[model samples]
Target: MAVGRPRTFDCDVALDHAMEVFWRHGYEGATIAQLTEAMGINPPSLYAAFGSKEGLLKAALDRYTERRAAWMEEVLSAPTAREVAERMLMGVAEKQTNPANPPGCLLVQGGIACGTGSASVPFELAARRAQTEEQLRDRFARAKEEGDLKPSADPAALARYVSAVSVGMGVMASSGADREALAQVAAVAIKAIEEQSAR
Candidate 1:
């Protein structure tokens, strides 16, 4: 008997599906069956294409990282540090509050769950966070150069602080915080960044 030709999977589409499944259910919660089903592929095909569930997740994260960079580019293009921070914080707040997105950042959610459970997860999570921080720092640095930020502002520290607040808001959203609560939290965070930049 001869083996039939296998159907080809669209790598990008499959990864997007995987990302959504993992984002919805989380790492420990999402099963291989769920991933494969959502991706419209079988176990053998999924494994053949991506090696393992973890491998697929890593690919999904890479996709997400690229998407984030694109978004950051838009956010950082604002005229002032306050505007940039507001743009990002408001965007996050909207997502966090939206019933559609369900308030979880994929990387942040995965990091929180996997960071403590596995050896490599924590490192990957840290790296992801570092990447985000670096982008924010760059934004802040540029704002300072344009006099949008005060001369005394510390871009590195501001970056760390803003990222922490953003991640914290995601956790809050996961914990059942409503849109009003998230908006309040976002406002406070953005205000703090602005006030500090002024000094």
Candidate 2:
């Protein structure tokens, strides 16, 4: 029996590069050739390490989510529900426009335009997004219990509203909207949250 050679490339670094390629070109748009070139790994290495292109994408999504865990925690830990909305929307504004990263979000851009062959990709991304909305709903429910939001406020609705705005901001960013535009969008979202909480 013969042993295969050890991988020379760093998996994390390669995944990060693959993530950027997916983020920039989307799932259907990104080719294996592009991913391999960006990741600095050959096709055989990618297949051996990730099993398949979808596998690599799943791994990249996991890495992207893990990188944002801290920020998500901070947003959820805000002192008030309004502040939570403020932090979330404004944070997205900053993140989506950051010069260092590709515009928009991986979860949003990665599967937005998937065709029939890649249909499952959109659902996978949607499930991740729904998880975010669920988290927001739970947080807002807690805020209502704490009197941070009015008793009449619907936590689920507020969560959906915020989630929708956040997703729309990502689309806007992908469409070349600047930070200032997103900031204005966030401001309006926060105001809506405030009003909704009051009512």
Poorest lDDT segment (10 consecutive residues) of candidate 2: 190-199
The TM-scores of all predictions, comma-separated, are 0.88, 0.96
Q: Please, what are the lDDT tens digits per residue for candidate 1 over residues 37-94? A: 9999889998888887677778888988887787778887887778778888878778
Supply the TM-score for candidate 1. 0.88
Cα lDDT tens digits, model 2, 1-199, are: 9998889999999999999999999999999999999999899999999999999999999999899888999999998899999999999999999999999999999997788888899998899899899999999999988887888899999999999999999999999999999999999999988975643
Candidates in order have lDDT scores of 0.80, 0.94
So what's the TM-score on candidate 2?
0.96
Q: In angstroms, give how far residue 176 of model 2 lies from its true place.
A: 0.3
